[model samples]
Target: MTATALPRLCVVIPCFNEAANVAPMVARLDATLAGIAWEAIFVDDDSPDGTSVAVRAIAVQDSRIRCLKRIGRRGLASACIEGMLATSAPYLAVIDGDLQHDETLLPRMLEALEGGLAEIVIGSRNIEGGDKQGGLTAARQMISDTGAALANAALPMRVSDPMSGFFALPRDLLEEIAPRLTGTGFKILLDILLSAKRPLRSLEIPYSFRARVAGESKLDAAVLLEFAGLLADKALGGVVPLRFLSFAAVGAIGLLVHLAVLGLLHGLGGVGFNAAQWSATLIAMTVNFLLNNRITYRDRRLRGPALLRGLVLFYLVCGLGAAANIGIANLLLRDGVLAWGLAGAAGAALTVVWNYAVSATLVWRAK
Candidate 1:
């Protein structure tokens, strides 16, 4: 193809158990792209609901509908990656197979690409004309809005809607950042934003997101937890040491519990022994472990024996972290008068770095 020639654009719909919506979804997508040189790829994540079979039938009649079946229980982001890799199209678009994401916005995205307005185009529900179908529940909407706000605040780039799954960008742009994408999660936007080397220009099209017509919605508790972790990863600049902030936050809370235990032991029980410190450490360690599993490293996928191994490695790392904390504490103590105050700050700063480096390299190495 000549450099001036407009390259092919492929639309990818990632579906899991979306068999019932595939036919109508494809029809709607076709209606929107009447004049565009485009093809629709339905990447099925080994759906048991015959989603792949239905798409295959569609493909037989219309060669534009391609289906890819994943080996294991894959997610939306992984499915999108599979579709992009299979096609030679320079531009790739993502929409929901369940018909929740508006396929009618495809033309607007294509128009923006052709106009050289944006490298990536997003369908936003945050704009004035944008809307959501079956309105989001207050709690769900709040969580989404809060997450987006926090992400925009944390990053240098500003996006009106960062959580929306419907968006389009060039295949070459995605290929450049493929190596940095490790964790299997739903937030491909975060993946792209974090891995993007050059400045990213974005366009937002106002559109309403509809409720799924066929399958049960997969937005469960586990997905939300993974979503939070992805947001945190981006917020921390994708550096492992940033996770130490999470560990430090846990440690700070533990210090509170430790002070209370110390008071209870000495003031009420009249005991001067170190038992209080030891007990508080045990309680805090347990709390940190639970939080790390459910929140900090939720997408790491360490389970059973692998999880136990990770825990052991975590403790070893923490031991080294504690030593670093002590070293900083001693340095401050040498300064006298304001020693305790400075020591506390020094210990926190030192441990944060130490913990993040070790945890990212060892405990959550799989991701």
Candidate 2:
């Protein structure tokens, strides 16, 4: 296609470990979008299975197909943003690289954009003709249903399926709302809709969700946690980043762990109070680091040597935080602004805030 001959549709397929499905996905799109000019962008997260390598090989043969290999960062929403920004196509859309969504609906979805019938056309699996039984396992269907409920609760206009990984809309509108999008997790469709300046004129076309032909389904308990973080982000008007919220939530869990460990050691094990407190804090800090690394800094998760380095650094950070907590509490008490209990509470909150801020910037610094 010439520079002026940009395709009418740019399909962004955010993927991870989708090496086997890349070529088949393109062939399906080629058949589905027969008369329409379109391009498929496979945004890969540098999967260990060489997903980008497979996409790159195909891209060289077909100009309409392209690949964006992201390094370091690994969120689906961020990958979608990268793919959308790289293309010049007027009508932008997204689909799972796995053969789950009905690619045939893509034509009608674009039709809505071409005819100005709607600002967005989602390939929905919850409409009249569509249902979860088509391909979903009972557990997956339950997860999808629960996710939809959580997503619709925060959406400006209710949608039959807000957790859908497949959808399409205008590039201009996407660009307009891109900056406001958290771009953190698997719910890019929901993010785009929720971030819109005005309620979008949207329509959903019924389509049967298909079973995955290749690769593993990316959904899990972690995804639901991330979805909850997105809801919290929107509920707070984006005042706090989703990862920070995740960090804080994990910290709360750590607090409970600390108390439990302290109780077990001091009461049952007959350990000295100071010794039990120190041991409990250390264990809690380790738990906090692991949870934060897994959920809060998932895209920046460390491995092997990096993991070892991170753990050591985390210990130092928490140690400094503990010292700061004690110092601040003593200062608050001496200043006579707060009683011992109130001062300690403020200091503990300070420690949590300091650890969270420092951990993200220092322990798991993302580029």
TM-score: model 1 vs. ground truth: 0.68
- lDDT of candidate 1 at residue 10, scale 0 to 100: 92
Residue-level lDDT tens digits of model 2 in 294-336: 8888878888999989999999998999899999999999999
Q: Model 2, 191: alpha-carbon shift in Å?
A: 0.6
Write one digit per residue (lDDT tens) for candidate 1, span 1-367.
5454343789888888999999998899788888887888898977899899999988999877889887555566777777877888888898878887878888889888878899889988888789853546667777778778876765557788887889998888888887776435776776677567555898888888776557887664555656655666665667753345456666677668767777787668877657766666666665666677655565454689987887788778877887888877887788673468788787867786777767878887743
lDDT of 1: 0.76
Clash statistics: count for each candidate: 0, 0
Please, what is the TM-score per model? Answer: 0.68, 0.95
**Candidate 1, residue 176: how far the Cα is off, in Å:** 6.9
Q: Determine which window of 10 residues in candidate 2 has minimal summed lDDT.
A: 1-10
In TM-score terms, candidate 2 sits at 0.95
